[model samples]
Target: MLKHTDIWRAIDRLAAQHGFSASGLARRAGLDPTTFNKSKRTTSDGKLRWPSTESISKVLDATGASLSEFVTLVGDGTGTNPLQRVPVIGYAQAGSAGYFDDAGFPAGSGWDELLFPSLGDPHAYALEISGDSMEPVYRDGDTIIVSPAAQIRRNDRVVVRTRGGEVMAKQLIRETATKIELLSINHAHPDRSIPLSDVAWMARIIWASQ
Candidate 1:
C-alpha cells in the first residue's frame, strides 16, 4: 500500500536533491511558496491534505522532470529513499535551547536541510558560521559540517559548547581525560582551556565550505 507520506516525502527529497527547499521548489513551480510546507500538510481540523495534481504537474514542468521520474522520486522518497540527509542550523540557533541532543544530533523540529553526497553519521549536521570569529580560514557564512560520530582528534577543527553556555569553533590544541585546550582560529582571540566536565559536547568539523 502506498502511504501519503511516501509520496510527499519523495517530493521533499526531489526538492532537496536539486538543492532547493520545499518552499523554493514551489516558488520555482510558480506556486505559492508554502505549497509544500509542513504546516500545510494537515488541515485546521487535523485532516491530512495532499498536494493537488495541478501543483504536482506544475512542479514536474518547472523541473523538466517526467512522470516516470516523478514516480521514481515517489519510490525513492518512500522510506527507501537512498540519500544521506543532514539537518542544518545557524550557529545562533545551535546555541538556542534544545536544538541538539546530548550526542549533538538535531533534536528540535524545523531544522533546515542539507543533502550530502555521503554522510557516515545520520546525526551529522552543518552549521553556518555567523561571525568573523573564525576568520582567515573560515569566514562568515561558511558552513561547517560536523559529525558527532566521527572520532575527535588532536588539532582538528571543532565546535564546542560548554555547559555554561559558550559555543565557539576552535582548533583542538590538546585534550585529556580531565581537560581540553583549544586554539582560536583568529590569532586575535586567545587560546582557551576548560575542564572536560564543563563541556556539554564536542564534535569534530569534517568539512567547511569557505
Candidate 2:
C-alpha cells in the first residue's frame, strides 16, 4: 500500500537526517534547488507537488542510500529530525587542488558532512556543475556523484584530474597506450585528447541529476 505522501515523507526525513533543508537536498540532487522547498511542495492551488522518480534516484545516489533504506526512512513514521552539518563544496571548487589534503579528503572550514544511509563504502563526494558548458547533457546546477574507487571503463562518464590540478567531466571515448580521448556531452565543445602521462587520476561518475 504505497502512497505519494509516503514518498514525500521519506524524502523529508532523509533531508533532515543529512542536516539539509528540503531545498538543500534538492540542490544536492541536481534538481532545481527550489524543487523540494517547502513552498514548492504545495502548489499554488494548495495541492501536493510530488517529487519525480528521476529526482528520487538522484537523491539516493547523492546520499549513498539504497532503495530499501529509503523505504524504511519513509515508513519510520517518526517525526523528522535535524540533520548533522557537514562540509559541502561546489563542483568547480572541488576540482582545484589544496581543497583536499594529500590523502584526498576535504579540508579547511565551511565544510559539513551530509548524512545518507550507510553504504559500506566511505569514499564518496558530491559535485555541483555550473554553466551551460556541458548543457543538453548536464544542465546547470546538476549534482553528480563521484566514486574515486569505482573502476573506469571506456565510454564511461568520468571526472578527470589533470597534473595541473584541474578537473573536468566528460565521456571516455577511447584509451590507448599513449593517450586518452574524451568526448564532451555538449556539442558546442569539441572533444579532447591528452597524453596518458598528464592524467593524475580519474573517477567514474556513477549518477547525475541531468
Candidate 3:
C-alpha cells in the first residue's frame, strides 16, 4: 500500500533534512539532477512514476542513512542531517598554479565554497566539469566531489594531474608498481597509461552533480 506521493514526499523530506534540494540530493547520490524533480514524477499522459530502488539505495549510501531510518522517513519524513561547505574550483583551473599543495590538497586562493552533504572527508573539494572530453557520463557544467585522502581502487572514477600540469578525469583501470592505466569516460578519447613518477597526484571522485 505504498503511495507514490508518500515516497516522493519522503525523498523531499530526506533532501531537506540533509540541507539539499531534490536535485542536490540526486547529484549527491550520483544520479541525474532531475531524477526527483516534480516535473519528472509523472508522464505527460499523467501516469505516476515511483523512485527506483537503485536510486533509493544510492541516496541512502551517499547520505549514510540506514534502511530503518529511511523506513521511518517514508512513514513520517522526520529528521535532520548535517551539511558541509567545501572548496570549489573549475576542472581546468585544477591544473593551474597556486590551486593545490604538493599533496594535491586544496590550497592558495581563488576557491569558492559550496554547501554539500557531509561525506566525512576533510580534504574533499568540488570540481566543475568544463568540456565534452568527459561527456555522456559527465557533461559540461557538472560538478564533481573529489577526496584526496580517499583510498584509490581499481575501476574507481578519479581525477588525475601530471607533472606537466595536465588534469583529466578518468576511470582507474589498473595500477602496477610503476604505471597507472586509466579508461576515459568518453569512448572517443583514448585510454591513458602514465608512469607513476610523472603523476603529480590522483584522487578518487566520490560524487558528481549531473
Quick one: best TM-score, which candidate? 3
Report the lDDT tens digits of candidate 1 across residue range 89-124: 899988877887777678977777766534557788
Q: Candidate 2 vs candidate 3: which has greater TM-score? A: 3
Pairs clashing within candidate 1? none
Runs with alpha carbons beyond 4 Å of true place in candidate 2: 1-87, 101-110
lDDT tens digits by residue: candidate 2, 1-210: 234566688899898989888888988988898777668677899987767658888999888887557756754366543232333468778768777664345667765445433322356566778888677767787777666667789999888777788778889999999998999988798888989898877777765544
C-alpha RMSD (angstroms) for model 1: 14.8
Once fitted onto the true fold, the runs of candidate 1 whose alpha carbons sit more than 4 angstroms away are 1-82
lDDT of 3 by residue, 61-96 (tens): 889886446655654334553456689898888999
Candidate 3 C-alpha RMSD relative to the actual structure: 10.5
Candidate 3's error at 150, in angstroms? 1.2
Which residue runs of candidate 3 sit more than 4 Å off their true CA positions? 1-80
In order, the Cα lDDT scores of the candidates are 0.80, 0.72, 0.84
Ranking by lDDT: 3, 1, 2
TM of each candidate vs. truth: 0.61, 0.57, 0.66
How much is 192 displaced in model 2, in angstroms? 0.9
Could you say which candidate leads in lDDT? 3
